[model samples]
Target: MSVSSSLTGRTLIVMPAFNEEEAVGNVVREVKKTLPGTVVLVVDDGSRDATSAVAREAGALVATLPFNLGVGGAMRVGFRYALENGFDNVVQVDSDGQHDPAGVPALLEALDSADLVMGARFAGEGDYRVRGPRQWAMKVFATILSRTSRTRLTDTTSGFRASGPRAVALFAEHYPAEYLGDTIEALVIASRSGLVIRQIPVAMRPRAGGVPSHNPFKAAAYLGRASMALVFAFIRPKSIYRTGSNA
Candidate 1:
């Protein structure tokens, strides 16, 4: 079947947001504008602001969590929503607007050959650079994950990604909710589960609005947390999903 065939009426954009009211609405609009008729589901991870209302006004389907579950929890909800609603492809986009909606098609198009496709920022596409311990940690994790998954992955910490049918089904049942689990550990889970993983170069932007998570001060904390994420990923067992067509 054609790659476009897999995407037709079967793709969903899942934005797991927390306290991103300023950018969520515009992000939603951009997704809709870029991919007309596509369903954009904003999983509001217990934002204290009017994120839900803004998202609705921008023409996105909002799912509000009672409390913040971080990116991993919110994403599991997205995967489940895709499964329940007959969507065969799930694309993860950051609500902070760092992930360009324009790059989504390329990621989805790569789904033609792989079960999971990630948008890699360091693949010579973007000038978006990280420094200090965060950069060191990302490089180490990427090298290890590239070996683990048996594919070269330059940006394992990237939040921009797309998952095909089998991946959606598997993640719905088994995606992790721990810190850094959504990005680093999730790739490990997919790789161990026998999913075909691939990544392409894409440019990321400075966050539209909000405090940056990575900085020199927090570099040490990130290194420690990232190391633990890898440990947890290795200890976690893998599985196969044979539940049906989606699987």
Candidate 2:
């Protein structure tokens, strides 16, 4: 995918981080290298480390939240920033360095026909093989979401995604503020709001540092909470999410 020719609209890459000092800098640098001239914004979720400073030094625009807003909140801030700054396209890349920067163009290329494009590690060949109960939960949610949205989705919990202007505006207004906010809830919002969702296979690297976001217990609870959120999304009026976009 040739991002240079495909991205005629202004683009912003949003990286939400929490205590990702060890990884954020290199992630920022890699993103800049992959998509030169595209704005990279790091939303520091009140990290107690040098994450913000390192990200700034790496040449990214930084926004430090006064407190931890979780990934969803941090990303909401990013969407708002994108909208306010006239960015027509937005991409969410995890700051933990798990997402490969080279796969960015695939998402952007998919965006040519999709309102939102997700980089699905499980959709095709990938290095990050999810296992155990979490893997089971992902499959269950993927099935449920695909059936509900009438679109096949292999990775319902994947955070790697690109959004168009309409998605950027609606999500900036009412993004889910809970666990799996960046993944399940955001996808539900986009589907219900009339956005076309597509998936492209992308490989991912392991986290650079820190523990995984969820343990076994939390993963189960996440499935339960996500189920409830899905119910709410289905009942919500679709007209409420409609936004004007030239694209």
Model 2 TM-score, all chains together: 0.91
TM-score of each: 0.93, 0.91
- Any idea what lDDT model 2 has? 0.83
Residue-level lDDT tens digits of model 2 in 153-228: 9998888989987888888887766767568877888888778898888888888876678776676576577777
Candidate 1: worst-modelled 10 consecutive residues by lDDT = 238-247
Q: List the residue pairs that clash in candidate 2.
A: none
After superposition of all CA atoms, the RMSD between model 2 and the true structure is 3.0
CA lDDT, every model vs. true structure: 0.88, 0.83
- Error of model 1, residue 223, in angstroms: 0.8
Worst 10 residues of 2 by lDDT: 238-247
Give the per-residue lDDT digits (tens) of candidate 1, residues 160-217. 9999999998889877799999899889888887899999999999888765656667
